[model samples]
Target: MPHLQTVFAAVLLCGAAHAQNMIRGEYWIDQDLGFGANNSFALAQQPDVASIQLPISLNGFSPGVHTIGIRTIDASGHWSLTNFSTAVVTTEPEPPLLTRVEYFLDQDPGFGEGTEVWSGTGTDAPGIGSLPDVSALAPGSHTLFVRTIDSAGHWSLTVHAPIVITAPDVASDIVRVEVFNLTTANDPGFGSAAALTVTEPQINLVEAALWSDDPLSIAQGNTLAVRSMDSNGKWSLTNFFSADVVHTNVADLFTQTGITTYPNPFSEGITVRSEDGQPLRVVLYDPQGKLVHDKVLNGETYIDLGQHASGTYTAFFWKELERIHRVQLVKH
Candidate 1:
């Protein structure tokens, strides 16, 4: 008879000897034929040797049936025949999911390039779907989608949900202002309310401005003065009033004085100065406190204001030690 091949029989063996059995195993990718091997051994008295398992690298392995095998090595230095097993692995790529969706208006009224349009959702997997109505887009981009995790921990495929954003029209009555009648009128102040009849156009303009160079703030009981240019480029004050604060854009305050910004109402280039004569560090932020520029100034620093539209900005100056000064700068 053939030499006793006790591999399978050894796998079924019980008691302490079963635990002492040593198993040598190997696996191979069916197509590439790349192979890997590992070995494991248990105490002789342990029963049911089937509990031992081996790990294999499934990466880049094609989806199909693969063969695996294990053998026993006896204390006498004799190798048993291989007892083989097979399994099938599958590889499937899941598409990205649309987790969040939002809608908003754009600034610089009139629908066109640079006008407010729906922005796709934020995701790492893949592209977002196209929006439903292009006409409703304002004069800027709006966040259209958001990525979210599901309960099962698996992300769903991408889905494009419809968004309806109304664009503002060119009209003097786009926004309305009403001053509140306060009993304490002599308090050296006035409270007012601003309302938008044509929300699309008015909101679009504000949203555009907020999204552009700096983020905008909406706070309760705050005054807002809006100036808009229509599709025909006709300039008009759409709304000017003090209302129950809805949003407030806080100006960034920089305490560093080591550097100074020249030309208060700058048109072109503004000079940054340092008092210590050391390399000066400068940073620029919009009213919303977002960093637009960060750099170290060698000698004198020149910043181009032509690219930025007329607006107020915060300039922060610093050095190796600490923040020295922060001041407001205006670009026209």
Candidate 2:
């Protein structure tokens, strides 16, 4: 009975001491004798506890099995016995990339969102021919977006390809096409001075804008109206496109770009940079993953976002095929 009471007292004392000590984890690769705490705290609690998701650098470790250790160091400078866990390190597979593209008429009901017929379920692979059997599509014009999914289930961005399904002998379907200028001048005479005459009816699509070549040439207010003609020489309805011009007053720069943004919900412009001594190319994407801007930098660059609508954006810094850094940008 006396021995039992002594053991109980010792256990209680250890638990009380631990309540005041700061507990942390350390790691040792393979059979290394020395332990290091380069990693973040796995667990830390006093009266209250918090969880942090900060990225831990693991550059020093190679692909192999390693044992990780955790211990407690109290305020009185006493070290606790290290507890260990085993870990296996392996390389993560790279995402697959789209190589080739071909399209056919989609005959299946409720298939794709766009006008083109497509099947979403298929084998995603690298170097494998992804040509869909087009022998079933009807004669018409369509488009397809091709993407690849890596073995790790990471899907790559899509790329668009145009496809034309020609009829037995089709011609002379076009008539006269009309466009309207709704910005600086509201034109009724089929846009500008006159309407466009479709001498060759095979043209399925028409595109025009005030800044067709130079985007900067467009002013603060501008819009474009466009439509097409079919084989019966009958004109289709008109589609309108508008643009909101923006200000380009930005001048300050930065030094590094490991997740950095200023005025968080920023206006007018945003500054970006990275530690990469060489020039950096920053690619900006909207919330929908649509690319909005691409710029090259020499240490620092001021991106004019005054014209862009207020929203959250993602910025990725690239070094050739490798993505060096990624961060979020907010525009007010």
Candidate 3:
């Protein structure tokens, strides 16, 4: 074996092609290196196909550019560098619409009560969808309004009807009363034993015309009860008073002179003296133009003002069409 020389050498290479072989449609590389030969390399190969497509299932996807890397392994167990690809996906939001409306009147008649008195539902009505119905409402007097709701569960607007309330009639001298005697038994002071009569001459009414032996004193205020029969034979109670009594003087039997109000600025009580035998009507008013009290006097009428708070009030005397007098009284 004169010329037997064992050559030992190794080769190292990088990049696209090194120690690789392309067989029948596939490429191959030998990774096994014998004693003196060791080689490692990267192979770059392109398939005849246009693109590598993979199925992806997603409910929602992001938009814009995307990158995909592809790699292949040769028979020699080597890998190629990663390649990049791109794609775009897009998505959009949905659109919006309308919901419900309601209507009604706040007053009893549901008609013309005031300006724009009617209120009700719907957004397109008027005044930012808050205007009450002024046209469809009744002509003379009524109340109305409306309300509306949107598709998003939001309320659109609320409308209100005009306010109208009638004031009570003040011209009628209707009053209520309770009667009491200031005298006691065995006093010889012309007390409860004396007969008592109460009457209203203008309205042709006789409230009480009898005598009670039981002495009663309404030093405290009392409520009087009076009833009248209408032309239809309907008996209705309409007036109330503090007390009732008979005329004491013979002169008072025919003239109203026996009935008179005393102590112009009376604080505790006021004496109503009536000399003429006729009934008299008394009307009392406070400074605020409110009727405080009213009554018909037929005898010595005593008004207890002790229950009234400190204030000035006006008292008016009336007998049918005639207004007797007006006096002012101060309370302390």
Candidate 4:
């Protein structure tokens, strides 16, 4: 390629004295041609502050970074310090075309050593390309470095981007099973229901007792929503089931079972008493007939109702299969 020529111009104060006229100036490029040993030029009118335009030729200079420096001689014939400017020279009319593209994950494997995605495309730009399988990589933050090679076999600077390989979801064992009554507005949502022991991955509700304080009742045709959580704390989608509803008349079943419940109208909590100090079960239901609370206690036990909304609730006292007494309680 033929050498490229460029003009370097600079406004210079001739040796710091504005009153002193600039008589002559000289400039040299690349190699310092040593003071007046290089080419010299005369200044017209010998102006004190000279706007000098130095024409430099890169006749034998190779295509790369080069510098040009210029200094002026005052009327007193004293040489001023040289002022330098740098530039890059290339023989190509335009930037080289991208011929190859390669990338490496996490660590850089050096230029031309990365996994090649494209080769000799002979284009100035390359669009999105396919990457190798990263399934073997561990989960966590990672980096991907990419670089390109030109038609001249010159590799461009490596460009890096962050690559995140998140940990895949692993199968987890079911830890707890819970149920909710979808038909009632008092449904405590998921995770709020009383947790049932999960002995296996699959659960059979028919064998599972629904006597907990959760709003789920053993009612037929009522949509019973069931969900299970795994050891990873992830909950499964609720599965709905409807079955036969059983009903027993409280007035007909009251048999003086020696179980007494007090404070029909109360706030916060209510107390259930087994007058005979015998063990008995108490089940409280919401206005929608969804079982809200169920527990077996000996003597007296207090149940918190303060968190419940202001409405009428029913409590059924039971001695095993026999229903002893029922009472309507109000919460403020």
Best by TM-score: 4
In the predicted model 4, the residue pairs found to clash are 220-243, 220-244, 220-245
Q: Note the Cα lDDT for every prediction shown.
A: 0.44, 0.47, 0.42, 0.68
Error of 3 at 266 (Å): 1.6
Q: Please write out the lDDT profile of model 3 over residues 1-332, one tens digit for every residue.
A: 12222222121222246544311121112222322132222333432222333332222335443333333344455544433344444444322222344556654333232234223444443444565544544445565555555455655456766644454433343222223322322222212232223234223332341121112232222233334433333333443343423322223322543345666566786777666646766666665656666666677788776776668776655443322345566666
Q: Native-vs-model 3 lDDT?
A: 0.42
Candidate order by lDDT, decreasing, is: 4, 2, 1, 3
Off by over 4 Å in 4: 1-92, 171-173, 178-193, 197-228, 231-332
Task: Give each model's clash number.
Answer: 43, 5, 44, 3
Per-residue lDDT over 1-332 for candidate 2, one digit per residue giving the tens place of the 0 to 100 score:
11111000011112223445445433343454543443435445442222222222345566665565444445445545554555555666443443322232333122122232322334443343556556666778776555444334454555667788786654556555555546756656533333554545554333322212212112212355666666565556776765433222122123233423455668788775555655555667766666677655666567887877778776555433222345566777
Model 2, residue pairs in steric clash:
105-137, 173-230, 173-231, 257-273, 257-274
Residue 277 in model 3: lDDT: 46
Superposing all C-alpha atoms, what RMSD in Å does each candidate have to the true structure? 23.7, 31.6, 23.4, 14.4
- Report how far off residue 55 is in candidate 4 (Å): 16
